[model samples]
Target chain A: LAKTTQPISMDSYEGQEVNITCSHNNIATNDYITWYQQFPSQGPRFIIQGYKTKVTNEVASLFIPADRKSSTLSLPRVSLSDTAVYYCLIGGATNKLIFGTGTLLAVQP
Target chain B: SQTIHQWPATLVQPVGSPLSLECTVEGTSNPNLYWYRQAAGRGLQLLFYSVGIGQISSEVPQNLSASRPQDRQFILSSKKLLLSDSGFYLCAWSLGRVEEKLFFGSGTQLSVL
Candidate 1:
């Protein structure tokens, strides 16, 4: 499992774009950068994933540079409902998943 | 579409009592099942995982034990609960390949008094 490092907390206003970056310096060649969002009292929800370069979904976008050591999760036009803890996981196609202390994004009104 | 189910949504148990939490998956076969515990104000810790029925791999060994009686059913149990065992338990299932995305259940909040 590739350990990830992210900010403990971040504050953003509604309607603004938010980007949370995660560092996984030991990322493997086959590892993929995946992000998950978790609201209080609810399970974590999958947001987006990328192996390299950029991958975009209707919900969010993931950017991975050539080094694969770090990645960014971008949420466009955020709202109060997007306030949650965001987790970044790096793993290969055959490894057990491990989650670390996620970045808590607080969307202010 | 694969879905995961876990119960009971919330549990309040006295110390020394036995504990059993169940998790099941639907719409997928031979999926990898995992049990994770998230302590209040903490990150998720992997407890156990199963690659197939009747096979379990323990990640953090403690008073807890896991069983997989069926391909889709995974159970987390304890002979006697401890105060430290109290936390939010989440059940998730993933495809055989890693990073393929995991589907999580609603999760159970256990409060040991």
Candidate 2:
């Protein structure tokens, strides 16, 4: 499993865009970057995934550079409901994905 | 179009007691099952995973054990609970081949005293 590093916490106001970056320097060639959101007392939910470059979904977008050393999870026009812990996992689909202490996104009113 | 279910949303058990928590997935076949433990302020720790029925892979030597009686049913059990076993337990299932996405059941909060 490719370990990841991310901010412990981030504060953002509603309606503003928020970007959380994760560093996985040891990412493998077949590994993919995936982001998950977890609200308090709930299971983490998938947000977006990308192998490289950019991948957008109805919920969020993932930006991965060619080097694949790091990736960013971009949430556009955030709201208070988006306040949660965001986890970035780097691994192949079959590999056991590990979760580190993720970035806690606090969306302020 | 899949739903994962976990039982006994919250559990309060005493030390040295036996524990059994069940997780089941619906709308999928031959999915991979996993049991994860999350301590407060800590990330998820993989406890066990099963690729098929009656097959389990333990991730660490711990006070907990897991079982898979069916492809979509995963169980976490402990012969004797310890105070350290108190934490949130989450059950998840992933489609084979592409494990990028996981469908997690609402976690079970276990408070062992």
lDDT of 1 by residue, A1-109 (tens): 6789999999999999999999999888788888999998888999999999999999999999999999999999999999999999887555478897999999999
Clash count for candidate 1 is 1
lDDT of 1 by residue, B41-63 (tens): 99989999888999899999899
DockQ of 1: 0.70
User: Candidate 1 chain A, which ten residues in sequence have the lowest lDDT sum?
Assistant: A89-98
Q: How does model 2 fare in lDDT?
A: 0.90
What would the per-residue lDDT of candidate 2 be over residues B1-113, giving only the tens digit for each residue?
89999988999999999999999999989888889899888889889988899988898798899998877889999999999999999999888554367779999999999
How far residue B38's Cα lies from its native spot in candidate 1, in Å, is 0.6
Q: Tell me the whole-model lDDT of each prediction, alpha carbons only.
A: 0.92, 0.90
Clashing pairs for predicted structure model 2, backbone only: none
Tell me the lDDT of model 2 at B66: 92
TM per candidate comes to 0.97, 0.96
Model 2 CA lDDT for position A55? 96
- For candidate 1, the per-residue lDDT at B64 reads 98
TM-score of 1: 0.97
